[model samples]
Target: MNYTLHQLQVFVKVVQTQSITKAAEELFLTQPGVSIQLKNFQDQFDIPLTEVIGRQLYVTDFGKEIAELANEILDKVQAIDYRTAAFKGILSGRLKISSASTGKYVMPYFLSDFLKEHPGVDLTIDVTNKSKVIQSLENNEVDFGLVSVLPDRLKVDEELLVVNKLYLVGNKDHMPKTAKETKEIFNQVPMIYREQGSATRLIMESFFERTKIKVKKKMELTSNEAVKQAVIAGLGYSIMPLIGIRNEIYNGELQIVPVAGFPIMSDWRLIWLKNKKLSPLAVNYLEYVRTHKADIINKSFSWIDLAQKAHKH
Candidate 1:
């Protein structure tokens, strides 16, 4: 019944990945080293923690239970560390944010300076789809949420940060040569789409529906990056935010093709429940953003303005 934290970590990782090789790779341990740690961990337990059959691995039901407990223990241990930093007069606590997936490109710019100044802050950022971002806000699960579109049903206050411009993009070699009507262009090249409920997908859909245009829908992908890759492979074109694909445009791998109603725009917003109490850490982070957002946007995000100028009609 005795095991070290190291053993618990190895066992938890093995349970999570269900593969010795993947656990080892993620933990930066040699495969043999991980195997030995796992074996040592299992030695202290009575019942089976894992099983192998036909070269596939499965964690026993008991193993899943242990892994969950071990994860809780690890989180408690990290909390202790954060508390220690607080005792030393450093700003310490959790600063958690759940962001929509495309927000991966935007949130870091806003967070970097604050995080750099407060190294004691234990930061947790979850980059997920739009619904999950809203869910996290509704449940009070995170200190903040980042999204380009405000949820109609949520009673939340938002701080506007930056402009998010979505454009019709395709692989440079595969796009139409001249500007065409929105519906015609969509028909000329099959439209790659983000999965249902994605904000960008809604924008694209509503835009076409309003214009009374019918588009040929090809592959439906779950993520912005996935849709971009599909377009780059010449499968289809998609509407993508410029923030996420600027490098591809600069590299000539992708192009922001011109159409009549070209750039769809939204504001990137930091949102939280209207009446929710904020932790001191969250308050400090918000203040930093309130004061520094403009400066950060001017300094770090000037490239966005340059990209916008090119899209101007």
Candidate 2:
């Protein structure tokens, strides 16, 4: 019972990461330091919080319970800190965000103004696949999560930030210039595909399913940049978000295929757990995004028009 908040924080990190080494690296503590704290924490309760099997960390049922309670305690502490800082008219705290990999192209525009306005805030942004982003949000590991696909299983509050429009793109010489020709060509040409679990890939698959077209996937790449490069090399076509490919399209390295049912639109959303109480800093950020989302999204995508003009000239 005589445990410090730091111990609880470390324990929660350990549970979330499932690695003492990873937890230490995240907390900026030595690996042995984290191990000692975790041991002391378990000794206080006289119950094993975690077990290691085959070099993998597993949280016991008791550990899971404690970790949930630790999260609650930490959330409340953060709320209190936020309240105090609000009273002083000074916003200062950490803002942790986990975003789907594709969100990297858009989130910086949304955050750039906020970060400049709140100079005292410490910010951390983690970009990963959509599944991991949702996992982080479910565990309350981040203040907010940015993704295009909303999870159905988790109860969350979400705000639609922008529309992510995906386009079928390929080398200009190879892609057909009209929707009819592109549709006819789609079944014959090999396509570069985003790796499984990508939001873009999922959307593309749904489009193909609806259109009843069987695509010949030539390569599966893990990142957007890789997919673009493969397409540039004449490997195949890919469905890519316009936000991520404006530069390439403008530079004449790639062009959007005017395929039927092209430009699949998906909603990009900012989400957090519905029942969890947000700190003042978090609330401020959420409110700012809600109020200025239109402007932020407009500015973020203004390049699309410019890119088109550049391509024309």
**Candidate 2 C-alpha lDDT tens digits along 1-313:** 7999999999999999999999999999999999999998988987789999999999999999999999999989987886677688988788999988889988898899999998877789998878888889888889999989888698888988877878788898776544353577787678888777788888888888888888888989998889999899888888898888877886899987766665678888888989889987899999989888889867677676565455334
Q: Write the per-residue lDDT of candidate 1 for residues 1-313, one digit (tens) a residue.
A: 7888999999999988889999999999999999999999988889989999999999999988989999999889988987888888889888999999999998999989888999888789999888888999888889899999899899998899989988898998887865465547876878889887687888888888888988888889999999989988988888899999988999988988887776888989999999899998999999999999989999877898888787663
| The 10-residue segment with the lowest total lDDT in model 1 | 177-186
**Candidate 1 segments exceeding 4 Å error:** 137-141, 181-183
lDDT, model 2, position 81:
81
Q: Tell me how many clashing residue pairs each candidate has.
A: 0, 0
> Model 1 Cα RMSD, Å?
2.4
Instruction: Give the whole-model CA lDDT for all candidates, comma-separated.
Output: 0.88, 0.85
**What TM-score does candidate 1 get on C-alpha atoms?**
0.89
Q: What TM-score, computed on C-alpha atoms, does each candidate reach?
A: 0.89, 0.72
Q: Return the top candidate by TM-score.
A: 1
